[model samples]
Every structure is written in structure tokens, then in C-alpha cells.
Target: MSGWVAVAGLGPGADELVTPEVMQALAEATDLIGYFPYVARVADRPGLVRHGSDNRVELERAAHALELAAAGKQVVVASSGDPGVFAMASALFEALEAGPAEWRLLDIRILPGITAMLAAAARAGSPLGHDFCAINLSDNLKPWALIERRLRLAAQADFAMAFYNPRSKARPEGFARALDILRQECGPDRLILFARAVSTPEEELRVVRLGDAGAEMADMRTMVILGSSHSRLIERPGSPILYTPRWTE
Candidate 1:
């Protein structure tokens, strides 16, 4: 059997959002490895061995994928949104770097998919039309101080910002602190968007000024975007358009 490992992105929620390249990899996979929820996304079929694991053991999962591939199994590691965006791609590389030298020779591929940030931006006009930065707000891998520092510096530089993992039951207060920091730097009138479950049936999109924006507005599934000082809204009879012009003074 030809052995290889593919780190594939499942895209944001919807089945249609998954890329054809990733779909092909899934179709050919003899073994599927991923977080439990993402593994559940693929339909069960003959000859496909699904290995669903916990959400936090990314590195272990990556090592397992490499091991399976080394043993001549066609393995696909699944990640929601883009695998490179706070997902399994980086973990796969990390494992490869530290594992046996032979692991490096395995056919490893990273497949791109539509991340939640881009999907959320498309749903609510173009909040990321200009220069923007995407940050993962969960402090599980890093320090909260670092997250706050990045938030402050990004605000100072006037970059439209996208935040992921904004809030969770385990760390609910971090997002509230993030809100306080944003208010201090960007002030009350800055436009912020709370887009939850971007392409799914449970999708919810709400735009609010910073002053009125609450921490409770976001959750793990929500993608939060904060417009720069230069961002503008074109209010119409019905829905509004939020975008940042390409040219800045």
C-alpha cells in the first residue's frame, strides 16, 4: 500500500464549503484521524478506519497520523476551517520535526480550506477588505498577557482584526477582559461584529459598536471582527455593509 498523510481542512461548518482537494483526500483515505467533532463530519464507509480523539491532544494526534502513514496506511488528518489556521497542519509539522528522520520522507500534504474568518467576512460584507490580522484568543497554548499585548498593538496600528475561540465555558472571562482592552484603545464607537456559526443553519450575525458590545455576544463558534478606526458602514434601507477602504491616510 502506498503510504502518505494529508492534513486536510474541512472548511467552516457546511459540507459545500469543503474544498475538492480535501474531498478527494477524504475519499482515498484508509484511516481518518481528527478531533471527534470533525471526524464525525465524514460519512462512515467501508475500509475507512476513523480514529477520533480529544480536542486538546493535537500533537499526539499528529504523531499517530505519522505513525500510521509510516506503517503504510493512507491517513488523512482532518481539521475544521483551514488546517494551517490554529489547526492540525502546524501540529503535524511539529511532530514530523521531532520524530524519526524517516518520518520526514513520508508524503505529507497540507490542504487549504475556507477558514471561519473569511467565511464570516463574506457573510457580513467585507470586514477584512484591507489589512487585517487573525488572532486566536484562547490562551491554552500561550499567555493571556501576550494575547492582550497583541490586541493593544494591533489596535494601535489600526488593523482590522479577526478573533477566534473568543469565549468558552472553561475560560469565559478572557473575552470580557479582551473587550475592556479594546474599549480602552479603540474607544466606544469602534464597530465590532459577532458572527456565529458562519455558514450553518444556526448562523447569527450582529454588528455593534464597541461600547454596546458585550463579552457574552461571543462564544467558541463565533468569529469576532473589529473594524479599524477607518472602517465604515454603509447603512441602507435593509442590511448594512461594513468595509475598510484599501487606501488609508
Candidate 2:
């Protein structure tokens, strides 16, 4: 059988958020490769072989997928959110570029799914309804100074922002520093959101002012959103709905 590789997004958490295309890819995959938790999200089937690796081994995992595909195995690399957004698709391509020339000729596909930012935004009204930018707060691959620079520029641009990989055990201080920067640049009244485990049973959503926002509000499972100067909250009977009005003066 000819070999192919599909980098598929499982969405934030809910199985229902997974797209039909991704589901089909998963069903047809002969081998599934991803971080341990993401790989475990798939069910065990008779013909499928699952390979789970540590979270830090993305490049290694991508290389393995390519090697498997080169040997005529249908491989799927699973990612929790959209594979293109702070996920495996970029790593897969990076590996492909550095691998054997023949690897470039393989049938590689990226199947999109509901990203965490969008899922969280939907659940918390339309906070991203206007112009926005998404940033990965983790400085694992990039420099912390670069992240800070980008954060300042994004704040200056007055664009609503979504942050992925906000805080983790090893790099707990980054998000706290991020909050400090935003509080300085965007001021105390700016709106911020913490959406944890979005679209899952354990999902939690909180909206707070920038001054009141704390790094402890987020973990690796959390997605953070900061509103542009134009964003505002509408008070309802229960919880308020936060949204960015489309019109700009």
C-alpha cells in the first residue's frame, strides 16, 4: 500500500469538536503518533498501532511518522488543537525539510479542527469578534525577550489577543511576567480571560480585568485572551457576556 501522513487536530477536548475529515483520517490510520495524552484520546482498534511520546519530543515524533510513511505505513500525527497553531504541523514540516529528499514527495496532509482559542471564544461570547492575534506564550523554542517584544507590539496594535500554552510547571514565571507587561501596556481596566479545558467536562471560564488577573489563573490546559481597547462586557441576568464590538470609531 502507498504510504501517507496526516497531521490531524483532535480539537480542544470534546470528541464532537473533531472534524469529519480528521475522524476519517484517524479511522484509516495504520499508525498514530503524538504526545502521550493526545494519542490516548484515540480508541484502540484491531488494525491500528498507536505511538505515544513525551510532550517535548515533537520533532522526534514527526521524524518517526515520516520514517513510517516512507516504509508504506499510513501514519497520523495527532495534535490537541489546530495542527498549524502552536502544534505538530509546523514541526512535521520542519522535520520534512531536514529529512531525506524523498520524504518531500510523500502524501502529507494537514486536517484542521476547532482550535482552543476559537472554542473558548465561542463559549465566552465573541471576545475575538474583531481584529485579533494569537501568540504562544511558551518560550521553549523562542527567546523570552522576543515574546515580551511581541506582547508589547500586540498590545500597542490594540488587537484582541489569544495566548496558548500560557503557563506550565517548568516555566511558571513567564505568564506572570506576561500579566505584568499587559497590565503596564494595556492598563488595569483591560479585560482578560482564562478558559481552562475548554469544551470538556472540566471546562472553566473566567473573565477579569487586567489588574486583577493573575498567573495562577492559568495552567498548561488554560487558554488566555486579552481584549483590545474596543472590547467590552455586556451585563446579563447571570454572567456577563464579553465581546468586541465590530464598529471602530
Candidate 3:
């Protein structure tokens, strides 16, 4: 039997949030691979082999998944949030040359799920109704210079921003620099929504000014959004949240 791999997104880990198709994909997988924290999210899952690794070992993790699949193990390479958006799907494809051609030869499927950005956006109200972009503040992979370039473009273009991997121990200044750039372009009045640990028990969402959302209040678990000038905070009797891009025109 030829080897194949399914890159699956397990959603935000609420059983209800997990879609039927993703559940079916997980049920069909013989071997599952993911980051340790994400692996823990599905720890109760049954009848599957788990390969959990530290965050820094993405290449190793992808290589291992390919190896297992090449051995004809029906592998599920899982990612929290969406696998395609700044997650395992890219690593898997990049690591293709590191594995056998046949293993890379078979069809590799990427199944989408609710990414943290979308989940947070929904909970906090719409911030991406029009043009938008996402940026990962982890400067470890891409240079800070490149990140700055993208942030500048996104800001100038007035794209609502969804920031991922906002801060890590080594790069404490990433989000700060990003915030600085946005503030410079969009001004201090811009609304910056910080959604920490969204969809989990520890979830917290706050709307702050672009000048105020800084690393002192953010960590790797945080997903920060910078709303465009068109965004607004609406207060209904039971709800007070941010909304963006009035497309009524």
C-alpha cells in the first residue's frame, strides 16, 4: 500500500469546534504527529500513535511524520488552529526533499480548521470583513527587517492585522516593534484587540489602543489584532465588542 499523509487541524480543542470532516480524518489516522501542547489537547484520543515534539523541532517533526507515512502508517500530522496558515503544512512541504521521493510522491492532504485569528475575530466581533493580513512576530524564521516590511505594507494598505506567535523569550521586542509601526502609520487612536488563549478555558479578550498593546501584556499564547480605521466598538445591551469594515456601500 502506498503511503499517504493527512495534515489535519483539530480546531480549538472544544469537541464542538472540531468539524465532522476533521473528526473523520482523525479517526482514520493510524499515527498522529504534532507539537506537544497540541498533542496534549487531543491526549484522550484513542487507537493512534502520537509523536509529540518541542516547538523548535518542526523540521524533525515533519521528517518523522513523512518517515512513518513512508513505512505505510496512515499518518495524521495535526496542528492546532489551521495547518495551512503558518503551521505544519508549510514545514511538511519544505521538508519534502528531506524524505524519500515516494513518500513525497503520494498525495498529501491539508484539511482546514478554525484558525486562532478567525476564532478570536468572531468572539471579539469582525475585524477582517474587508482586506486583511496576518503576520507572525516570531523573528526566528524570518528576519525582523522582512517582518517590518510586511507590517509597513499591511499598515499602509489599511489591512486589519492578525498577529501570531507574537512573542517568545528570545525575541521580546517583536510585537512592540509591530505595534510601533502600526501606531506610526494609523495613529494612536487605532484599536488593538488582544485575544489570549482563545477558545480555551484560559481565554481572555481585550480591546486596547495600538500604543498600549505591548509585550508586557502578551505572550506566545496571544493573538493580537490591529483594526483598521473603519473598525468600531459597538455596545448592545448584552454585548460590547469591536467590529470592522462597514461594507454597506
lDDT of 1 by residue, 1-249 (tens): 479999999999999899899999999999999999999999999999999999899999999999999999999999999999999999999999999999988999999999999999998899999999999999999999999999999999899999999999999899999999999999999999999998999999999999999999998899999999888898988778888888898
Window of ten residues with lowest summed lDDT in model 3:
98-107
Determine the C-alpha RMSD for candidate 1 after optimal superposition of all C-alphas: 1.0
Best by TM-score: 2
Q: Look at candidate 3 and tell me the lDDT of residue 7.
A: 88
Candidate 2 ranges with C-alpha deviation above 4 Å? none
Q: Which stretches of candidate 1 lie over 4 Å from their true place?
A: none
Which TM-score value belongs to model 3? 0.94
Q: Model 2's lDDT to the true fold? A: 0.95
Local distance difference test, candidate 1: 0.95
Q: By how many angstroms RMSD does model 3 differ from the true structure?
A: 1.7
Higher-lDDT candidate among 1 and 3? Answer: 1
Model 2 agreement with the true structure over 121-206: per-residue lDDT tens digits: 99999999999999999999999999999999999999999999999999999999999999989999999989999998999999
- Give the candidates in order of TM-score, highest first: 2, 1, 3
Tens digits of per-residue lDDT, candidate 3, 195-237, equal 8888888998888887666667788888888898788888787
The deviation in Å at residue 24 for candidate 3 is 1.1
Model 1 lDDT at residue 202: 98
